[model samples]
Target: MVRKLLFVATLSVASGFKVDQAPVKTALLQLRGGADATQIAKYVAYSTSAFMFIPAGRDVFSPGAEIMPDDDKLLGKMFTDKSKEGYMFMWNQWGVNWIMLSIMKILAVSSGSADFLKLGFATDVVTFAMMFKGWIPEFKPFVVMFGLELLALGKLAFA
Candidate 1:
């Protein structure tokens, strides 16, 4: 009985330290040649953000948009149906920021640098804070956007 118990213990200990012959693949390993998860996630995040301009046109981009809760909204009534200037201001603001981020992501991917992902991570943090703080109203599309940002953040962090 004692011999059998000792043999079992030894086998368990040996198996615990057993190393697989196969190379352990990771995101870092994928970084060498082809597109890694980080690059894909970054591209997805930026591209999705850029395309948001289309869907948002009904709200912030148009004059007399229906989404404005109040005329004196912080974003400015002029940007809403209250005035032409306010609408233009909000529209340009969205376009510029979204487009710039997308361009940065493209540059980062093509250059094979993780530097630009840092910006994306930071932006995600701020956006999340805004959402949680109620500065930005919660909506179904925003939830989806938040999930994409989270995915990018995870890849950025691990990579």
Candidate 2:
């Protein structure tokens, strides 16, 4: 029974180590031209859209005590509507960011350099700042996103 318990513990530790190293391994592989360009592009698309949604959601749901005037334009109204505001705003923000990032990623892949990836990552950092500008005055989200962006930039740069 003691031997079995030790074996299980060792296996669990090894599994956790592998999980932590997965991203690094993938980054090394990508650097060696072993990664698929299409797949990388897809990841960039998904990640940027997902990141943009966070701010939009916060804006709609957590606008704080101050209320802005109702926007009169169609797109503005759709995004500012009380009931469906969060979803609409998220969708709208995601759409714009997604397109921009998609183009940048495509250009990066085409040029065979990771500069555009870094640029995209930087753009995200800025977006996060703008997103939380007046809402919370908190640095936690920005810091977290900054760390993630650094990791992403490192992966792309080495790729």
Tell me each candidate's TM-score.
Answer: 0.52, 0.34
Off by over 4 Å in 2: 1-94, 106-112, 136-150
lDDT by residue (tens digit), candidate 2, 72-125: 222342344457647656655555555556466546644656677677667766
User: In candidate 1, which residue ranges exceed 4 Å CA deviation?
Assistant: 1-43, 56-79, 135-138
Tens digit of per-residue lDDT, candidate 1, span 72-149: 344452344544555566666675666676566556545656666666667666776776776443344565676686
Per-prediction backbone clash count: 5, 0
**Candidate 1 displacement at residue 54 in angstroms:** 2.4
lDDT per prediction?
0.61, 0.55
- How much is 60 displaced in model 2, in angstroms? 17
Estimate the overall C-alpha local distance difference test score of candidate 1.
Answer: 0.61
| lDDT accuracy of residue 77 in candidate 2 | 29
Clashing pairs in 2: none
lDDT, model 2: 0.55
